[model samples]
Target: MSTAHDRERAWLLVTRREVVSRITDKSFLIGTVLMVAMIVGFIGFTAWQEERTDEATLGATPEAVAMAQAVADAAPQVDDKLEVRLVELDDDAAARAALEADEVDAWLHPVDGDWQLTSESSEQDSLTAATRVVVRQQVLADNAARVGSTVEELEAGSTVGTEFLRGDAERAAVAEAVGFVFVFLFYFAALVFGMQLASSVIEEKQSRIVEIIAAAIPLRHLLAGKVLGNTALALIQLLVYLAVGLVGLTFTPYKSYVPALSGPAAWFLAFFLAGFVALACLWAVAGSLASRTEDLQATSTPLTMLMLVMFFGGLSLDGRGQVIASFVPPVSAVVMPKRILAGGVDWWEPLAALGLLAAFALATVWVGERLYRRALLQTGGRVSLRQAWSAAE
Candidate 1:
């Protein structure tokens, strides 16, 4: 009974209402504020922890100052810049007790003919190695001068200058963390909110709203409007969070506190937006399959399972996913970004992945519209993925 004009107006009204509700909703605003607060609190907590640790270990002692001066006087590399500490224990038992208690970074004692170094189990290897070199050189010079040996005879063997061929350790570590966070965040967000999109569609359909919609307008317009409306809502939420994060980073106190927000951050944000759009359309279609809100799990289980596979597969991207994973929609979001972050993939790789995902998402939206039309009128029993696909045909 409704005219095309009436149906078009109805669709617009529904979509506008959704946009307004999402943007102005009390719960959404509160949730956004809480998320921002949590992020800022985490950053502040980590800095406090690091500062306390540095304060505990980096201080000077009288005996340590004397020993450090002696070592510095012997070796050029042993500069007096380091804050050294000493725990002058009466015996090895006392030293062992102090080490067990973690009261010092290192302890020096006289061995049979040379000095002995003792420290806690968790002492930094690099610091310990540097200390040993300084002390050994000083001992060697004193012994050699007593026996009239040459400087060359007392000098230790040369150390190799190791060069990495494929990757630097710090770079690799940063790349891996960036990749992991991007992939995981993308996957989880898609899976969680994507299902919400699906359920939203199914609820409207079950209530006979789609029938009223279909009587006046084409099925395609109705479906497209719904998907667009939901996608807009999700994007608005993401942008707000990102804006809060950027604002927090601008403060000078948080200079070293922010995540590396340079090249990788930019790329990761781009990929995340593209990936969200690609997945959200398909999820909207999945939501249309259910006749009732309770039927959602039955209809959406396959897509949910696919999302899970993509999530777990992302964890192994650096290890197992080199070639085969770069093109599979959900999994590709994780894998391709990982390769790019690792500096292991070409620039063209992300383009190819995005292209594939876009194509797949469009195809899914088409199929989903057909299913939405068919199932929009059916209710009472469960609607399965097979039934939805067959209805689309």
Candidate 2:
């Protein structure tokens, strides 16, 4: 009798071989480097947007130099990113020339005891806000000096109070963006690795590799090993990506903003494992159904379309629908993690979803075994699902 331990060792050897093969591939190495670069570039872009420190050069004529200086001094109070560097312009002609040259974002002119700012757009938000505050303070100071009063006393005008009403549904926009990455990453990973899984199976079967391997181990063990191996690779790929993202986050202004995403990240990985396992089996089934590499697309279209629905459906659905989707099998494996970030997910919700997903994955494995067993070596042409299902064992 084949003991459980012997079967474990046998399947483990198969899994180890697949993992080694995938990681050692030249394409995987190259792809990892490219993925790293892409991750860095995206992180840098997001960090730049959050900082908004793009310098806006200011050409200040002699008359407005003092006001510009005042604004520069008050820049810290307005916005840390708001930088004002004064460029001395000799005359109006020079100022216009500076503007034309695009050497300055705006020409600051003092006309008739008021500041005039000439820019491409009327709305120069940082400049406008800083100038207004400085001007208001200047006016108050002048009045205080004339009346023998303090600027603070004169500036104590009517107050406007503000408050925010937050609800349970109100999640940070940044959090949702992070969650989208998690879900969408899984969506993409499933498609890519799923196809890879199918291709791997097809290649082996075509080369008669599966027959040689199956002569020693049970076909089911070989199947389990293949699934386990590829699934490990898929997970490692996601973890590498997730690690890169988290590390990248630390360098970004979003670092502080998105730290709370750890909870969602954990949930994402949990669902990712289950979802990919289910998808990976179908991928293997697709491979089993196809006779040649050319037949892969045609045979796998149904399963490919199924995952595509999860991707597109995730984009269109929200709230109750998304919540409902979290519990559904393959969809649950992708969208539910995002729902955890996007809404008030109950503690029991993930447990229930995971349980259901586990059951579905097991069912998929059994079906995948059936498909793989009946059709894997019958490689004269593409095998129909009906024929594979009803064909004699």
Candidate 3:
């Protein structure tokens, strides 16, 4: 019998081999570089879009010049990025010419003691809204002055304030966005790495290399090594992506969201580690049960379906359903973090969820090892789960 120390060394060797081989692989390195580039490029593009300003020019006849200037001055108050420039026109004819020549986005002229605004195509909403606001303010001020009062005095007690009885709306919106990122990361890592692990197992079994390896070390150690090694790689890749994304967020208006997201982000990583181990073990079992690459699809369908359910559940679940899901293993891996970020969960909630996930992960490891051990040396075609379970050890 192998000593405990020997078994530890044995699995470590397999794990080191797995990690080293993947790190040295050109495709993995290239893929990592490409993903990083994409993240940086996306963030850069978003920041550029946010910083870009929209300019609108309005042509105004002499009688409407004051109204046009008022619109220009007030436009920025509504949207800081909006700049409305006034182009003084000699007459209505001149204003029409400016509009035709694209010298101004719109034209303003006085008709029947009211302003008539015309644009070449559909009216710009920003300019239109600004014009409405300016017109309303002018009318209100005139009325207030006629009554021997100020606009502020006339509009006193007219404004309404909002109060949130539960979580903050703005913070919850940010948390939802952050939760989406976490869901995508978890789904992507589980699908990609899980399939890769499954494929690796099937490939080794098909090549009969597992027979030689199984003889020298326990099959349980082999399974443990592969699962842990891939889990490590997945975590490293996730960390890199998250680090790049967080650093990129600093360049955008959403930088303030980072500090609030930090705690939930940490919890996501912890849950992901446990959740992925469980999924990875089942993937290993899926591979061992399959005799060839073509057979992998049939064997892995259940795992795929489970992942899909988790993916959608993470995004769509809310209300009492969300609260219930937050306690379930694997599903809780995504749901609990989202709830924490959205607020209202007790302090012990995540801890309890994580405990359940950890226990589930351990159970999967034990069960997956049993199935993997029985099926690893089977030489014929695909082995059914029942056959693998009943087969002699």
The numbered model that scores best in TM-score is 3
Question: Which regions of candidate 2 are displaced past 4 Å?
Answer: 1-9, 44-52, 60-76, 87-91, 109-116, 120-171, 257-259
lDDT of each: 0.63, 0.81, 0.90
Which ranges of candidate 1 are over 4 A from the true structure? Answer: 1-13, 45-82, 87-106, 111-158, 162-168, 205-219, 243-270
Steric clash pairs (candidate 3):
none
Point to the candidate with the largest lDDT. Answer: 3
In candidate 1, what are the lDDT values of residues 1-393, reduced to their tens digit? 876687767657666766776668787678767866876775566446534322113112333445545543443355333434444455567666766777756666655765556667666554455568777766677779899995567554765566655477656665665566666667656775687677767867777776776667777666666666666776666566555555554553444424544555566565566667656766765666666677777666777787778777877654555567867775676777777667656678778887887777667666666766666656656666567567643
| lDDT head-to-head 1 vs 3, winner | 3
- What's the CA error at residue 194 for candidate 2, in Å? 1.4
| Candidate 2: tens digits of C-alpha lDDT, residues 74-143 | 7657777787777888888999999888888888787787778888645578877776787678768877
Per-residue lDDT of 186 in model 2: 82
Candidate 1 — what's its lDDT? Answer: 0.63
Looking at model 1, residue 309 earns an lDDT score of 80
**Which candidate would rank higher by TM-score, 1 or 2?**
2
List candidate 3 segments past 4 Å from native. Answer: 1-8, 110-116, 147-150, 165-169
Task: Give the Cα-based TM-score of candidate 3 against the true structure.
Answer: 0.92
The 10-residue segment of model 1 with minimum total lDDT is: 52-61
